[model samples]
Target: MKKVIIVGAVGGGATAASQLRYYDKEMEITVYDRDTTMSYAACGTPYVIGGVIEEESSIIMATPEQFQDKRNIDVLLEHEIIEIRRSQKQVLVRNLATGKEFTDSYDALILSPGGSAIMPEIDGMDGHVFSLRSYADMQAIQSFIAREKPSHCVVSGAGFIGLEMAENLSHLGLEVAIVHKSASILSILDEDLSKILQKELLSHGIDVYTDAVIDKINGNTLHLSNGKKLESDLVIMSIGLKPNTSLAEQAGLSIGVTGGIQTNDFMQTDDPFIYAIGDATENDDFITGDPKRVPLAVPAHRQAFIAARHITGNPIAKKGLLGTSILKVFDLDAAMTGLTETQIKEKGLLAKTVVHIGNSNAGYYPDHSKLTLKVHYNPETRQLLGAQCIGGKGVDKRIDVLATAIYGGLTIDDLQALELCYAPPFSSPKDPVNMIGYKAIE
Candidate 1:
């Protein structure tokens, strides 16, 4: 039986451990995480902070007891893997609680330590600031909020976590403002689309500022580069994240252009016996075939299964990701798949895009909501390259369908002819997807 050792028991590591046990019950599987908790939903941290989720414990997917009792997997909680000695096929493990260190050997190793939130150094940036990357961060912020009763909270970025923090802070009845260093909010979206999102955020009474960066934070005041200062009681930094690759790099694993552990279609790293998955691994883009770091839960879980299958002789290869993602702020929902127009142009690809405004369902439907759909296509062949959507109720569905289309290499003609279910309560005979396709044909 092969001895498998896994590091960092988040979505990727946890799924790999479970799948490994399923593939080979006789294999000795040991999972190690520095956190005291077991497999939990890190993505749900924002909801817990916003008060939408009443209990922090509910976000945890499984406990250490569940892993051992149910899966027969040994989970070492509060144990950290400080070093990986690939030549010896062993790892140096340290017990965070006991301050004791040990070494363990493995036939195969999987790296999935994930990424940490970026906190830029600004004056007065100490315990008063927060970053919602882990469950502990969530707990810490909740405790501080309860104890301090901050009246105004300033969120220092406007990406997914940044905006989510802004919304959740408002839910807690605290005045929130989002300060984005970039010219537009949601830099992931096109500039024009970002304009629309800014309007929506403002409509909800959240202060949205762009091209604005904090110079320093001084006791209840945020000094800005524009020589302006805003008073706030707390600051949540959501700038960005860099892949945690120290363990992999130290072990002589090859890193990619994107700063993530490089892996092939089989999710195998440079060393055949080693594999890396999840937020820590650089993945291939389905459209561009370039390495990109997509740090999301579903991709991490899927990659984990792929890595396990390959190691166990099942060998199910992983296709590239389209980087499909979604976000919700207050009542509005936005989803995107494949490349953005900015990316397309930057790549020097000859492409054009069209944006359409329509309703989620039929116009006559009572609960219908407006939707903005933008699609990128190869101008010469009208091939569907990418799509972005913003709306309520039906945003995820549309983006999901487009994601499939891009994966299948469907062209404009193909999308227009695609069959889809339709009802007044759900969609029109010509769904928004078909409309974009039909427009592309025009």
Candidate 2:
């Protein structure tokens, strides 16, 4: 019987443990998490905060007891793995609740400590400020909102989390101001597309400040570098995430340029008997083949399968990542898959991009709506590289098709050739996706 131990039982770790148990029923498995709530969807935290999801417990997919009973996998909640002894093949773990320490030996180990919220040092920033990373963080933010009933919120950082927090806080009827040091937000979208999204945000009364800086925070007052001050009742930092790789670094594992654990297509680290997954590991870019960190839940869950299959002796290679993602803001929807024009330019890759606008449904239909679609392709080979879509409806479905097309090694010609179903209520005769493809060919 093989003994396996997994750390950080959230998206990646929990999924890996479940996969291993499914493949080898007799395998001895133990999963440890520093937090009590394990196997819950972290991505759904924003909706819960916004009252879009009413029940907090509904997000939890499985409990420790449930996993232990059904999967026969031992789950230790509120247990922290402090150290890994590579030579001894054992981990020194401390019970977070009791401060008691113990050792667990393993024939194989999976590392998935995930990422940490990067909170920069600003004057007077303390417990009063917040960043949502875990279930606890979400609960704290909710508690603060309920207790104080704050009317004004200053959310620093205009990235994914920042935007989501901004929208959710605004949905709660609070005036939200989004601040970013950059000239524009959403680095995933081109400047023109991002400008349109910015206007949509302005229509919702959400304040956006680009090319901005936070000078200091004194009590409830936030002073800006441009000599502006806001009476802020709440502050949320959504700057970015740093990969949790200190354990791997201490264990002498190799790190990548992206500051994540370096692993092969099999997810095997430099140490053959060990593996890493989730936000803690860097991924190979599908289009540019660059070392990239895609801190999304879907890729983490997929990596679990790849690691588990290889551990069970299948030795399957994983497909490189496209960093496919989507988000909702008020009445609008935005999604992106594959490389962006900005990234392609940075990599010195020649890409032909086409931006097209079309109605999602037949123009004459009552429910028809316009969507902006951008597709990127190799100028020479005409291979499909990436795509972005912004619209009220059908954005999600369109992004998924483009992601699949990229994965299938499809080209611009292939995209135009894709035979898609159409109805007066749902799609136009020339679907928005096909429109982009046809534009790419031109």
Candidate 3:
């Protein structure tokens, strides 16, 4: 009976424990988490803040009691792993509730410490400043909104989380303004698509200020480096996320250039007995095969499966990551997978991009929506490298198709022969995806 100790019991940790139990029912598994809540939908926190979810409990997938009862695994909440003793294969744990310290020895150890929100150093950023990363963070923001009845909000950073928070905050009847440090909102997309989104933001009564940073905060006023002053009742700092790799670093594990713990295809660190996964671990990029950190939930779950299978003597090599991601912006859906053209250029890769602007479905169909699609491929080899799509409908479907194509090693010309579903209200005879493929050849 091997004893396994897992630190952090959210997405990756929870999935690993369940998958491990499924393979070997006799192994002893003990999971520890510093936060009180575990196995909750961290991605849905923004919608819950906007009253779209209605209740916090709706996002919780499982409770500690449920895991213990159903899987016969021990899940200890409010218990933090203070130190890792690699020599003895043990972890120093502290009961945050009781302030008592204990030692837990393990045959194998797993680290899934996730990540932390990057809060910049600014003067007077003491009050009403929030960053949504966990369930508690979401609760804090919701409580602040209900208590303060804030009428204006200033959101810093224009990434996925930043844009989502802006829209949700606006949904609560607040005058939302986005102040991004970059030249455009949603840096995942190119400047052309970003400009299109900026127009949509302006049309929805949201103020946009690019190439700006918050200099200082004075009570309810925010001073911008762009020489603009804004009186905001609330402030959201979604600058970025940094992987919580201090524990792994302290344990003498290698950290990759992406600031995540270095792991092999088996999610194992230099220490064969210790494994790391989730946002804290760096894996190979699916397209470029370079070290990359993907903080998305889907990749975390997949990595967990690989780690668990390896531990159970049923090893499966990881297939790498594409960093596929998507988000909703007002009436439009923005999605991307693999690398952007800018990224390709940065890597000094010779790539060609093809863009197609067409209807989501047949033009004659009622309520047909427009879609802008872009695909990048290697000009020499004709291999698909990446893709981006923005549209009112069928955006998710098309992005999924493109992501699958890239995963299957499909070439730019291969998309044209894809037999995608077509109907009057669903899609055109030659779908936007097919059009992009045809255009790529031209």
**Model 1 lDDT per residue over 98-179, tens place:** 8999999999999989999988878988667888888888889999999999999889899999988898889889888889
Clashes of each: 0, 0, 0
| Model 1 residue 86 lDDT score | 84
Which pairs clash in model 2? none
- Per-residue lDDT of candidate 2, residues 12-90 (tens digit): 9999999999899999999999997999999999889999899999999999999989999999999998898999999
Q: Report the poorest 10 consecutive residues by lDDT, candidate 3.
A: 196-205
Candidate with top lDDT is 3
lDDT of 3 by residue, 1-442 (tens): 9989999999999999999999999999999999989999999999999888898798999998999899999999999998999999999999999999999999999999999999999999876999999999998998899898999999999998999999998889999999999998888798898888888888888899999999999999999999999999899999999999999999999999999999998999999999999999999989899998999999999999999999999999998899999998899888899998788989999899999999999998887899999999998899999999988989999989999999998999999999999999999999999998899885
Residue 219 deviation, candidate 3, in Å? 0.8
Better of 2 and 3 by lDDT: 3
**Backbone-clash count (model 1):** 0
The alpha-carbon deviation from the true structure for residue 24 of candidate 1, after best TM-score superposition, in angstroms, is 1.2
How does model 3 fare in lDDT?
Answer: 0.93
- The TM-score measured for candidate 2 stands at 0.98
- Model 1 TM-score is 0.98
Give each model a TM-score: 0.98, 0.98, 0.99
